[model samples]
Target chain A: MSSTLRSFGAIPAQRLVRTLLLAMMALLAACGQSSEQVDDMVDFSPPSEGVSSAEKQPPASTGNALQVDVGGALAAAPALPPAASLDEVAEAANRTEPEPLSITIPGLDLNQVPVIASGVTATGEMEVPSPLEVGWYRYGPTPGEPGSAVLAGHIASEGVDGAFRYLERLKPGDQLSVAFNDGSVTNFVVDEVVDYAKSALPFDELFARSGTSQLALITCGGDFDAQARSYEDNLVVVASVVA
Target chain B: MKKFVSVFLGALLSVAFFVVPSSAQSDDARIHLIHGIPGVNVDVIVDGNVVFENFAFKDTQDLSSFAGQTLAGLKVNAAGTDTTAIDAGDVALPASGNYTVFAHLDADGAPALAVFENDTSTVAAGNGRLVVRHAAAAPAVDVKANGAVAFTNLANGQEAAADLAVGTISAEVVPTGADDPVVIGPADLPITEGNSLIVYATGSLDDGLEVITESIADLGPNPTVVNTGDSPIDAGVPVGAGLALVATALIGAGMIRRSQGITVDA
Candidate 1:
């Protein structure tokens, strides 16, 4: 990561300024912006042929067909429509319009900004290794979808709490705002707060689509009991975009 | 004097465009840019079934394209939704043994796959090849004399190469509190190579009281909502204590994967 002196150290003054400007230009190359706060991912590009609202959703939960997830002890619940296939998702990303998204909740003093990438930081937060388990997906759909646009932050680094140290304080009815590059600011209100043992977590809940656009926020919570060197639970927050 | 300043500024502006040939590319895959903690984790699923959930960094696409200055002077609501940057990733692993890796590709042509058992009873290194066919398939991987290539020939999307270094990596010198994040000789085992390593915390993250207070005081253009006693409305705060209760049951099995091996050439 060293910026070595150019070969033409004694280049003309005019050329030196040119070089200076070029350095700035090289820096202009933004790796890529990620929408990681949410847990799920859609291609960066929009779907080529989007399904109409009518075709996009399942029939009312008339107790008919619900995508269900079951655990040894946990009960089954309706499932969500899986996002486009992997190929379609990637194609969407290729055509995706990555604009800077930022948000702030005045009542909560919450800042929903900074989408981190793997081994590539935004402002802060570290990169999860590659072929990452869930590489904490950074680019995802806007909230209100039955998907978990998951974003993982570090909690402990040598006896220290990382970015998501105090994620257990938010309550229902709180505000979660999103500001996109298009100048469109959208806010979501907390609707549900559910906790699951990572083993018993309702992966289905994150993607449970019910016609209502929902946003899912997940983080590691519970105690960091040093003895165990791991957290005891998971925090999941479901919210709906402020209509 | 005024003329001299104007000309100097003019010259500076003129040389800005072509003088600097970008030495690096900004195509990134789905991974963190900075190593925050000790390991990397990813849980890959297709349809509804879990294909792989790796907690450690193994074979993954590179996301080093995040080399740029933060956007500034955003006077207007940056509109029109034009793409400012893009990234691509493709990885290659060469070994006589069987190895399988998966990534989320956008479309059928965007992905490819092939079995490398080879044309004859024995697979030859240079003779074996696979292409990106579909999600049901593996990324198009080709074996070359010196190495291998895995990527789409379509010249679209953020295409990056995942280099798998095959060899005995030196034992890692993990952070033992006494060491300064780095150690001597084959330090940072399993994951060998000269590339930076990142670790993600398992619990929620906040600046804590003292850390948060300092962050606010030093709020430059880049504002980070680090936890502080003064900022009661911090976004990092968990929705409730219920999360702690749930974390207990999931931490062990929740660890998507244990150790994934990867090597990056410096």
Candidate 2:
């Protein structure tokens, strides 16, 4: 065993100890580094869950209503067949026109930044547009719709500042606007700014299609990996429709 | 042996520090209630409690909160009277996914209840899902999208569905093997991406057939990763610095091996 170790150029015992210490430090630095910013005003529940049963209750009913006879009704109504299995058909050819054309954030001094619809890449990562433009997640809701619409932009690329470079500086109550193809504009108010580790982002909540209308502006933040050329965290700015 | 112990400890520590996020989707079922029986104002009672009074045709309600719960003595009575129209005893809502319950006429034109589960699966980008359900008191019909037969021979109480690119398509419903005498409209239907647009052939054919729609949204793939930036511009500590530290540690390990009289390869 010693001969084999020698042929492999055995590391000195002190140097091995130092290497182990450095690895430990690196591991420690990467642990429990949560940056989520909690906002009390935002209701994260889906729309269905938000409604109460009492709201569906009819106006005070007369106590004279008698118990319904189920036997006769059941005899008259035939039992429905089991749910049918859906058949796969050929794909349809028609496509919808993209709605959102541009976005504006007055507080950030971003005026009418061009927006483009984008989809996921082959690897399942969101395909980001150029630093000069913002990418709207095409599969999600459009801005001002009854769901969360996601828009992602770059903070910086290759030492150049991106369209969302100052996204972290946005505060609650900041105004933002989105213009659609129909020449209509929807205004929004920033609800909160949160920073999350990329691995820990709540994808369901960020892309939910129920509940109040929302817009999520996303960009890169936190530690940058030089080798991977990526950021370790994402900064999200959530905004709600101005109604 | 000491070196092996230290290396093992380092590996164990790294493993202990790794974090994995949970990716479980919510298990809450989305339920919608629709009134398809025309010419009658009714009171909807679930579990012997009147949930909707004076409910007219085309009135819809979201019953999502009742997911996973069974309602006993589900009854629809004439408005302001005790006359029972349809009684569905002990209806159990699904624990998850999307569903719609309709009060419509069966093929025999009798008041009946039909429960259809809506597909909530993620749609491909740039596409939308369309579901055609036959709930009217009509015979088997062919559903046309953009004047093409998309769903054929769809009988009462059955459903057919497909995914199509997001756009507007002219929809029409006609009797099987006949294009003339349309039972329903050639109305323009908008197919929005990430949503399942369910069109129901509702109301009795003799009483005037109609079409009602329900949309289930948010069925889209979440991006596996969002890499919005390149370069370490915002990083407090560059990853290269950490790599450098790791490289230095490896070099130290090499030095220690040399001190232990391990032969250095030429």
For each model, chain A TM-score? Answer: 0.47, 0.62
Best by TM-score: 2
Q: Taking the tens digit of each residue's C-alpha lDDT, what string does model 1 give over B9-115?
A: 43333223112211111122122111111122433222222322332322232222211111111111101222211121111111121211222222232221211
Give the CAPRI class of candidate 2: incorrect
**The 10-residue segment with the lowest total lDDT in model 2 chain A:** A36-45
DockQ of 2: 0.10
**What lDDT score is found at residue B60 in candidate 2?**
74
Clashing pairs in 2: A10-B257, A11-B256, A11-B257, A12-B256, A12-B257, A96-B166
lDDT of 2 by residue, B60-92 (tens): 766654443334456889998899888765454
Q: How many residue pairs clash in each candidate?
A: 119, 6
Query: Which runs of model 2 end up more than 4 angstroms from their true locations?
Result: A1-112, A117-123, A138-149, A157-160, A165-197, A210-215, A221-243, B1-27, B45-51, B68-70, B80-83, B93-97, B230-266
What i-RMS does every model get? 29.0, 27.7
Q: Cα deviation in Å at residue A180, candidate 2? A: 8.0
Question: Which of the numbered candidates is closest to the native, going by highest lDDT?
Answer: 2
Candidate 2 Cα deviation (angstroms), residue B206:
3.3
lDDT of 2: 0.65
After the best TM-score superposition of candidate 1, give how far the Cα of residue B130 lies from its true spot, in angstroms. Answer: 7.7
